[model samples]
Target: MSQISVVFHSGYGHTKKVAQSIAQGATAQLIEIDNDGEISEQDWETLNQSDAIIFGSPTYMGGPSWQFKKFTDATSKIWYNRGWQDKLFGGFSVSASLNGDKQVTLILLQTLASQHGGLWVSLGQLPSSSTAATRNDYNSLGGSVGVLVQVPSDADADAIPSGDLKTAEAYGKRMLDIVNRFKK
Candidate 1:
């Protein structure tokens, strides 16, 4: 089976919840970015072996968390060696504010992947734009970028919308399907 690696930094539990759903659906390994802004050597090895990599982080102050940015910087060594060239790359982010410039965060991730010569993959699923679709519809416009979960600053993990979680799972599954096809 083709391996997939998800590396992310989550300040609150919202992003972590989305990452877990992605891992579950893709059967991919989850690598947490440590407080020191480093991934375990073993996890780095897994990324080297994996067919795809999915990045996650919460949008903070119009960008991704500092921790995630540090980790990305550290990957420069890998990039020099063309380590991730041609590998599938995807990303997700969460924010407390409705328009927190989450797309900027995704663009940052895409740029990093491009710098490493990786192939970027967007949320392949389209939003249900029909009037018949409700706010809770799966893969809605707001659900783009794997799962852009929204939670009030004071809200707890329990407050996350179920729709966001479901969308994340589906994103993971879709990523795996692409990985499997490319492996063939």
Candidate 2:
């Protein structure tokens, strides 16, 4: 099995819920970026040894949370050494609005992976965009670059749509499958 790690920063617990779903499907280790945006040296070691890495963060304002950005900035040393090079990389983001600029966050993650010379895995799932389609359907948000989720401002993390959670899990599995293929 491929060694996968999910590195994420969750504010208000919403992003953490999504990360859990993804980790559950990938059987990946979860590395949380704490409130200070600091991770232990062990987390860095785990990332260096993993076959795949998936990034997760909440979309605050128009992009990823400041904590996530801080964590990414701290990865400059790893980027210089190309520590994550050639690994399978994927990402997901959560926002409060359907069009809350979550794509910007995903793109930032993709760029981070690219900077480290890693290969990216797309969501590869079509949108559930039909009269018969509902929020409970998988990939209802129609994400191609990575998984995208929307949680209403008044809602708690538990209220995250089922389809979005399922999509996150499936994306995790997809990354694992791709890593297995590529590593072989």
> Taking the tens digit of each residue's C-alpha lDDT, what string does model 1 give over 52-124?
9999999999999999999999898999999999999999988888667788899898899999999887787
Give per-residue CA lDDT, model 2, range 96-159, as digits (tens). Answer: 9997999999999999999999989999999999999988899998889999999998999999
RMSD values for the candidates in order, in angstroms, are: 1.5, 0.8
Query: Model 1, 21: alpha-carbon shift in Å?
Result: 0.7
lDDT score, candidate 1: 0.85
TM-score of each: 0.94, 0.98
TM-score of structure candidate 1: 0.94
